[model samples]
Target chain A: MVSMLALLITVPMLTAVIAAVCRGRFCRLLLLSGSILHLGLALYCFNTRIDGRWIGLTSYSEAILLVLTSGLYFAVCCYCCSWLKAEECSKKSLWILGICLPLFLATMTLVILSRNFGVMWVAIEATTLFSAPLILFHRSGRALEAMWKYLLICSVGIGLALLGTLFLAFAARMGGVELHDLRISEFLNIKESLNPGWFKVAFVLALAGYGTKMGLVPFHTWLPDAHSEAPGAVSALLSAGLLNCSFLGVIRFAALAPDKVGEFCTELLIILGVLSLATAAFFIIRQGDFKRMLAYSSIEHMGIASILFAVCGIEMTMIHLVAHSAIKMSLFLLAGNLLLACGTRQISRISGLFGVMPANAILFLAGVILICGVPPSPLFFTELVLLCQAPLWLALLMVLLLFMVFAGMMKNVLSMTMGKKCELEIHAAPAERLIWVPIAGLCAALAVGIVFGVNL
Target chain B: MNMAIDLVLTAFLGICLMLSASSRLVHCIRLVALQGILLGVLPLLMWNWSKACPGAEIWGAAFVNIMVKGVLLPILLIRAMRKAGVKRELEPLAGYSWSLLIVSVASALALWLSRSLTIPGVSVLAIPAAAVTVFTGLFIIVSRRKAITQSLGFLAFENGIALFGAAMHLEYGFFVELGILLDVLVLVFVMGIAVFQISREFEHIDADRLNLLTDTGEVK
Candidate 1:
C-alpha cells in the first residue's frame, strides 16, 4: 500500500533498462507488457487509498491524471509497436527509442504522484529532458529544430517554477508557519498562514512557468513545431500526457493559495485562459500543416480546460481533460496515419484520405468533431458549463473564438479528408492494422462523456 | 560570515556583467564556470551547523555540489563547445554595449526591489545579486545567437536560482538537491548533444537561423 506509486514509477524504468539490452522484438513485447502492468497499478490505486512521503494518490485530481496518463500510454504502446515495425530505423536508433519511451512514462508518473512541490518541479524538468529524445525519433532537420525549442523553452519555464517554489517557502517562513519543507499536505495545513504578497507572486510565476509546458498562449511557441515533427505515437503521449502534468503543476500551486487570494487566482487563470483561446483561435485559422493544426487544437482545449477549472472547478476540468485526451489521442494517431498514406504533412498537398485510408479519415473527423465541442462529446458539456458560469462579455468572446477555431480547423480538415484521391506512397500497412488504438481512444471519449453525463 | 556571503555574491554579480558584455563565447563560458564555483561554495557557507549535525554527510553533499557545479559541468560544456566549433556570438540581436547597459540597469532595479522584500533571519544581499544574475542569464540567452552561448546562458540561470535558494536559506534536503543536480546534469548533457547536432545539421549553430517552421499560411 505504501509503495504503490513507487512500484508504478519504477516498473517502467526497469522496462526501459531491460529493453535497451534486449532484442528489438523483445523490446516491443516489453513495452506492451510494461504499460499493461502500469495500467493495472493505476486502476488498483484508484479503488483503494495509498499514501507515502513523496508520492501518493491523495486527491480526486491526482487519481484522474494517473488513470489518463496510464490509459493513454497503454494505447500509445500498441501504436508504438506498430510504429516501430512500420518505420525502418536502425538498430541503435530503435534501442534509443526503446529506452526513452518508458523513461518518459516513468518521469511523467513521478510528476503526477509527487506530493511535494520541489519533487514535482524536478520530475517535470526530467519529463522535458526525457521527452526531448523521443522527439528526435525522426532525426530530421526540422525535428531537430523542434526538439531544441521544446527543450530550451520548457526548461526556462520550469526554471521559473523552481523560483516560485522557493518563494513559497520564503512566504511560509515570513508568515510564521512552522513547516520543514514544501510538502502539499503541510502547505494546506497552514494555508491561511502564508504571506499573501509573496504567495501571489509565487502563484503567477508558477502559472507562467508551467503554463509554458501546458502550451498556454505567449508560451506556446514550441507546441506547433514540436507536435508537427515528432512521430505520431510520441505526439499522442505529449498532447494527452505531458500537458496534463503541467496543468497538474499549475493547479497544485493554485490549490495552495490562501482563501483571501482564491478569487485572485481564478482571475489570473481566466485571463490566461481567454488569452490562449484567442491566440489559438487566430492561428488555427487556415493552418497549412495538418499536424500543426491539431497542435493548435490542443492549445485551444487546454485553454478551455483552464477556464473550466477556474469557472466550473476541478471536477469539470478533469472531465474536459479526459475528453481532450481521448480526442487528441485519436487526432494525433490518425494524423500519423494520414502522414503515412498521404506522404505529406501540408493540408494543401494531400486530399481524399477518405478514398485511401477511410477508417483513419473517419476517426480523424470524429476527433475533430469532438474537439470542436459538438454534441456527444464531453468538451461540449464542459464548454457549456464554462459559458454559463463565466461573465457575459467573457462568454461571448469565448463563443466567438470557439466558432472561429471551428471554422479554421474544419476548413483545413475538410479539404484534406474529402477530396479526390491523391497519389499514394502506401507505407502504412502496419499502422493500418493497428487502427484499433485510436478507435478505442474515440470510443473511450464517448464513454467518458456518458459517464460524466449526470455525475456532475 | 555575512560579509563573506556578500563578497562572493558581489563577485558573482560582476561575472554576470562581464558575461553580458563579452562577445566571445569562450570568454563567457569561463565566466559562467567561475560563477558556478562561487554558487557551489555559497551553500556550504550558508548551511547552519546546529548541534549534532551530520557533519560528514552535510559536508560531503556540499563538496559534491561544488565539484559538480564548479568542475564537472564546465568540462562537459567546454567539450561540447570544442565539438560545436564556433567561438563568438557575432551580430547578436542586442549589441554587447546595449545588452550590458540593460543588465546594469536591471541589476540596479533588482537591488532596489530586494530592499523592500524583508526576508527575515538570513543575509538579504544575495537576493538582489541573484535577481540580477537571473536577468543577465535571460539577457544573454536572447541577445546571443550561438547555440553554445544559450547553454552558457542557462548555466547562469541555473546558478542564479541555486544562489537565491542559498541566500534565502531554503533547503529542500539532500536527496532533492541531489536529484535536482542530476536533472541539470542530464539537461546540460542533452543540450550539449543538441548543440553538436544543430551544428552538424544546419552547418551553423545560430539558433535564430533555424526558423523554417512558421505559422505563415498556417491557418489564417
Candidate 2:
C-alpha cells in the first residue's frame, strides 16, 4: 500500500491536471470531489501514525496546518461552486482557478508533510507559484499588478528561505553532520554543536523569508493587494492556508534556536508583530475597499498570532490560527457574497447590506463580532494573554491598536450591514443558501473559541 | 585550486557589477545567462572528481544548471521580452553610474561581512561573490522599470543563491539544486505569460507604473 502521505500530496495534483483538461461542469465536479476527498484524507490522517525518513514526522504545527488547509480548502471549494454557479466567470478564469486550486492544495499539503527543510522550502515556493495564477482570476490590470508583486516578492522571500536552510545545513555540517541528513529533526538533536552566529543568521533569514509569506510588517506590501485582487475563496485560502504554512516554517526554525538565540528570535517576532499590528491599525481604519479592509485585518490577526507564538507558546498559537482561519474564511466568503450582490467592493458604495441580503448581512455582522475578539471569542483571551506577556506600555499600545482595528472594522461593517435601506441591484446569482458553508465554519469557530477560553 | 575558484568567483562578481549598469533588457538577459553558465561550470571545478567515477549527481546538477539558468531561462526571458516588445530598460530609478557604484559598495560590504564567518572548505571569495550577485540582482529588480528586466533580475537572484549553494558543496545539494532549477524554470515561464498579459493589457511592462490597486480606494 502506498503511504497515505504520498497520496495526500499527489491526489490534488492529479485532480488539477484532470480539471484542466475537462470542460466546465466536469471541472467544478472535479474541484468539489477533489476537495471533499482531500478533506477526508486530512481527517483520516489526523490521528493515524506514520513512519519514514524526511517526510515522516507530523508535528502538532504540521498536523494543524494540514487539517486547516484541507478544511479551509473544502469550504472554499464549496463556496467556489456556489460562487461560480451564481456569477458567470470567464471560461479563462474558471480554468485558471480550476487548475490552480488543486495545485495549491497539493503544494500546501506537501509543505505540511515535509519534515526536511529543503523539501519544505521547495513546497512553499511551489505554493507561491501555483497560487499566483489564482490572483489573476479576474484578468484585471490591477489583479495583474497584484500577481506580479506577489510572484516577485514571494519568489525573493522563498529564495531567502532557501539561503536560510542552506545556512542551517552549513551550521550542522560544521558540527560534522552529513549534508543528506539535513532534516530539521536532526538539527534539533545536534543544535548544541551548531555555531551560534550562523544559527542566529539562519533563524533571522528564515524569519524574514517566511515572515514575508506570512505578511509581516516590512514584507507585507504584497499581502493586501494579493488578497483583495484574488477572488474571495482564493483570498481565504491564502489567508488561512498559505500564511499558516509560512508560520510553520518560522515555528520550526524558532524551535531550533538555543537559549540565547531563542531570546533574540522571540524579541524579533514580538517587535515585528507589534509593527504588523501598527500597520494593520493604520490601514484598517476607513479602508474603502471591503476586501482590502479584510486583507489588512488578516495582517492584524497574523500579528496577534505571531506575538502569541513568540510569548504564549506553540499550543496557543495553533489555537489562534484555527480560530482566525475559521472566522477569516467565513468573513472573506461573506465579503465575496457581498461583492457578488453589490457590483462594487467599495465600502462607501455599499449601503444597507441588511436590506439587500439579510442572511449574509447577519452572518457578516456575526463574523465581524467574532473577529473583533468579542468577550466570548477565544481571541479575547488570546489578546489578554498577549497583553499580560508584554511590558505595560507595549501592552497598552497593542490594546489601542486592537481597538483601532475593531473600531475601524465595526464602522465599516455597521454602515454596510445595518444602515438605512439603500437598495442596490443584485448583479450575481442568488446563492444566499450557500451561506451554510461559512455559517457552519463560524459556528464551529465559536464553539472552538468557547472551548479554547475554558481550556486556557 | 583556490586561485582557479577565486578567478571564477571574481568573474562572477564582475558580471554582477556589469549587470547593475546594463540598461538594455537583452544585454541583461545575456549577462544573466553568462553568469548561469559560470554557475554551471563552477561546481565542476570545485568538487573533487575521481577518474574512477566523476559522479552522475555532479554532472547532472551542472548540466541542469547550465541548461536551465544559461539556456532555458534566458530563452524564456528573451522571447517574453520580444513578445512584450520591451527593449532597453528605460529610466531606471537609479542611473547606470549610480547603480554601478552601489553594486561595488555592496560587493565591498559582502566581502567584509563574509570575512568574519568563513566555512572551512569553501573558497573565501565565493561567499562574497555570491553576496554581490544577490545584491546586484535585487538592485536590478527594484531599480529597473520593465517587468521583463525584473524577471531577468529574479533569474540573477536565483543564480546568486545557486552560486553560493554550489560553492558550499552541500550534501543532498544535487536534489535541492535540481528542485530550485525546476522552480526557476516554471517561474520564468509564468513570468513570461504575466509579461505578455501586462503588455497586451497596457501595451507596456513598466512594473512601477503597473500599480493601480491601492488601499485608499478611489471609488473606481
Candidate 3:
C-alpha cells in the first residue's frame, strides 16, 4: 500500500524527466503512457485502502480528489494526444509542456496524499511553478501577460498560506502540544489544545491563500485571464484538476479549527461563495469571449461548491467537485474544438456552430446544460441538496444568482449555435475519436449523478 | 541574544519601509536580499545552538535560505531588470510619497496588532516585523508599475513570511525548508523569464500596459 502511494507520485515525476530529455514523437508517447499508468494507479488506490506513514488517503475527500485528478488527467492526456498532433508550437515549447505537465500532475498528487501542513504548502506552491509554463504555452503577448499575473498573484497568495501554516505550528506550540513535525495528524491529535485565537488567524490566512489559488472571489482576478489565455488542455486542467487541489488545502485547514472558529470559517466560506457567484454572474452576462465565459462559470461553480462544503459537509462538496470537473472538462475540450473550427474566440464573431461543427456544438450545449444545473445533471442534484441545507434567504439568493448565470450562458451559447454561418471556413477535422473524450466525461458525470441521486 | 534578535528585526522593518518608498527596481531587489539574509540569521539567533554545535539540518537550512533567498533570487531579478532595460518606476498607481506614508502608518498598526494578539512561544518583535514586512510587500506589488518590481515585491512578501516562520521557533524539517527555498528560486526565475518576454513582445514591462485580456471586449 505504501509502495502504491509512493508510485502514484513518482511515476509522473520520473516520466516528466524522461519526457523533458527525449525529443520528437517519443515525448507524446511518454506522456500518454505515463497518464495511463497514473490512471491505473489511481483506480487501484481507489479500490483498495492504501494508508502510509507520511502520505495516504486519510479521508474520503482525499480519495475523491485523487480519483477526480487522475480521471481528468487521463481525459486531458487523451485529448492532448490529438491536440498535440494539431499543435504547431516550437519544439522548445513542446518540451516545456512535456516536462511541466507531468510535474504539475505530480505536485498535485503529492498535495492530495501528503498528511502534513508543511508538505502540503510546498506541494501547492510547486503547482504554481510547474503550471506557469503551461499557461505561457502559446508564447503570445497576451499569454505573457496572463502568465505574469498568474505567477505573481498566486505566489503572493501561497506565501500568505505559508505564513498561515507557520501560525498553525505556533498555535500548536503555544497550546502545549509537543510535536516533532507539522503534520495534520499531529495537529488533529492535539487539536483541542490549540489556541483558539491563533487558530482563527491561521484559518483566515490559509483560506485567503488557498482561496486565491482556488479562484474564489477577489482573489479570483487571476482566474479569468489565466484561463482564457492558456491553451485549452491547460485551461481544462486548471479548472478541473488544479482548483480542486487548492480547495483541498482549504478543507484541511478548516478541519483543524475549533468549534467557534469553525463557525466563523463556515460564515467566511458562505460569504465568499455568494460573492464569487454574484461576481461571476455579473461578468458572465457581459463576457464577449467564449473561453472567458467558461472561466467565469468555473468561479460560479466553485462558489456553489464552497457553500455546500460549509453547509452540508465534504460529501456534497465532493459530489459537486466530481460533477463539475467532468462537465467542465468536456466543455473546455469542446471549446477547443470550436476554436479550431472558427479560429476566433470572440462570441460575437462565432456563428452557426451547429452547422459548421455539429459534434462540438451538441457537446458544448450539453455541457452548458449540465453546468447550469438544468435537470438530471449531477450539478442540479448537488445544487438541490445545497438549497435544501442552506438558510432560506441564502438559498433564495443562490437560486436567483444561478438563474442569472444560466440565462447568461444560454444567451451566449444559443446565439453561437443558432445564428447564420460566419465568414471563417470550418477547419474542424472529423476527429470523431477526439469527440469521445468529452462523451466519456459526460457519461461519468451522469453516472455519478444517478448513483448519488439514488442514494440521496 | 534577545538584543541581537531585536536589532535584526528592527533592521528588517526599516528595509520594509524603505522598499515601499523606493522606486528603483535595483534598490528594491537589494533591500529584499538584505531582508533574506537577516531572516536566514534569525533561526540561529532564536534557537539555543550554544548548547551544542548545531546539527547539519539547522546549518544546512540556514545556508540554503541565505543562498537561495539572499543571493540567488535577487541576482535573478537584477539580471531580469538589466534585460528589461528599465530602472525607475516612472509611474506608479500609488505614488512613492503616499506609499511611504502608508507603510509608516501600517508599521504602527502592525505593532499595535501584534501587541493585542499575543501567542506563547513566539517572538514579540518578530511578529510585528513580519506584519510590517508583509504589508509593505503587498503595497509594493500593488503600487509598482514595472513587472520586475512587482516580482521583487512578491519576494519581499515571501521573505516576510520566512521571518515570521523563523521568529515562531517553528522547526520545520530541513527538507521542507529546502523545498520552500527551491520553490521561491523557481518562482523568481519564472517571473524573470516572463518579464523578459513581456518586454520583448510589448516593448515594456509596465503592468499597466497589459490590458489586452480584459472582459470589456473581444480581441478579435
- Fnat: each model in turn: 0.59, 0.65, 0.84
Q: Which runs of model 3 end up more than 4 angstroms from their true locations?
A: A47-53, A430-433, B112-123
Docking class of 3: medium
In candidate 1, list every pair of residues with a backbone clash. Answer: A285-B219, A285-B220, A286-B218, A286-B219, A286-B220, A287-B218, A287-B219, A288-B218
lDDT of 3 by residue, A407-444 (tens): 99999999999889888777867433468899999988
Ranking by lDDT: 3, 1, 2
lDDT of model 3, residue A48 = 57
Cα lDDT of model 1 by residue, A6-60, tens digit: 9999999999989877845476889899999999998988865565668877888
Candidate 2 lDDT by residue in tens digits, A322-344? 88999999999888888877878
Candidate 3 global Cα RMSD: 1.7
Worst 10 residues of 3 chain B by lDDT: B116-125
Write out the backbone clash pairs for model 3: none
Clash count for candidate 2 is: 0
- Scored against the true structure, residue A318 in model 2 reaches a CA lDDT of 86
TM per candidate: 0.97, 0.96, 0.97
List pairs with backbone clashes in candidate 2: none
Model 2, B91-209: lDDT tens per residue? 99899999999999989898898888766788889789888888888888899888888888888888888787878876545675677677788889999999999999998888989
Model 2 residue B72 lDDT score: 86
